[model samples]
Target: MKSLETKAKEELRKAKSDIFSLEYQNKKVWVKKARGTFSSALHKFYYKVFPFEVLIPVETKTGKETIAFETAKLDLFREKGILSPKVLFKNDEFFILEDCGKNVNSYIRKRDITQEKMYYYLNLLIVQLALIHNNGLFHGGAQARNFTYKEGVIYAIDLEDSFTNIPLEVLQFRDVLLFLLSLTKTRASFDLDYNYIIEKYIELTNKKELKQSLKKLANKISFLIYLSQIKLINSFLGRDVKGFFKLFIILKKL
Candidate 1:
């Protein structure tokens, strides 16, 4: 007479042996069995700016209860009314989530995006983030890959890594900074308006400090850009100096 929870745990253990339970439309659903150590918060920032995933260690969870912990976190986001995947099923190994929609990258690839449209979508993404932070939550991974859009609404995904470990203010600002960095990847060549985006986010949240936070971040980015210009520092940091300068230019324009 095992309880339903117990049964689910048993299924999760079995799932580790056979990773993928289903697959379709180039999207594979499986329990990623290998658990690795978590990255430091600093590396999370580098992850947005650098192409060093090849050298990064896998996320190795120290215990078997990791999946359960992740499942609970996803449930909390849904309860908070944040747009994210709904848990369809769960166990200790992995949980099946309802497909929210196409991720931002896929949605943008469908056609040539006008600068106006890019700005509009970027503004919407930031607004959604404001809503999440307003609810006292922080999306640890705020890159475009972790977000999807459908029917005029944006949804966040990959809650397993989302957390509240840092202060709400720091986390909120990191989310903003990371998201802006992500847009640089997509629309690097476009003459985008960073000021409008930041202003609108501050307006939506009514957080005056957001503007200050962004200013400080812009300064730090500018420093990085200068370092990137140094040949020795550039080689040591493995930074795309041009990319750093580009991002700094965008932020400075704000």
Candidate 2:
């Protein structure tokens, strides 16, 4: 077995690859390049069953483009005094980064976090995302899985999906929606109120527009859930039904 650093360097030299992961100095790092496409068995199965292209998130840029984009994004976060990973080395094919720590999902799952602690952590994530949006940027995939906690601080990661092509308003609302959806999915039992989370985000950003957009989006999603519940539409639009009802419960509260 090669050292993690050696593997990382080797992967960077490859012409084409899908995902590369290795550990260096007791820290884990990885790269995701397009070596064809990857999807879960569930996703593939559903596509065959439905045979319709759903409007899904796309990464049009190659791994090289993503590396440069994320590198610049990291610099921007640091300049704005936000906590995130630091780039150790980068090139067109891939980049090496300082592993921040366990993602929020892993941390929460590994320990029994108190309700108070959970609220604190969630609020911190919302505020950090709010800060990023307030600075006129958006993390395309704003989920707990993309956030890390270490040494009493939360760090954002998986920024290759960050983008600025859309209007800031749309992206801001999208950021909140994506986050709440991800949060609800992680919590198998709908034990948390998403409204308070959005309220906190609105408070941090002081953006009344975000509050309005959030309400509209929540209501729209809630209606879809209603349709699914009525069998008028397929759960997850014929995709994953694992958390559809849970998401409905979440949106209703919102």
Best by lDDT: 2
For residues 1-254, could you state the per-residue lDDT of candidate 1 as single tens digits?
65434544566666646333344344434333324247677777776665332113225454345556556767887898887766666644445666666778664433468766776667768878888888887776677777888788898876545332445676667777767666555533454466777788888888887666555556755666666668876566532345446666666555
Instruction: Report the C-alpha displacement of residue 197, candidate 2, in angstroms.
Output: 0.5
Model number with the top TM-score: 2
As for candidate 1, its clashing pairs are 35-60, 35-61, 36-59, 36-60, 36-61, 37-60
User: Can you give the TM-score per candidate against the true fold?
Assistant: 0.70, 0.73
| Superposed model 1: Cα runs more than 4 Å off | 1-37, 40-65, 109-111, 162-165, 187-189, 227-241
**Root-mean-square deviation of each candidate, in angstroms?**
6.7, 5.9
- Residues 73-133, candidate 2: write the lDDT tens digits: 8888888888888877666655667777778876443345567777777877887898888
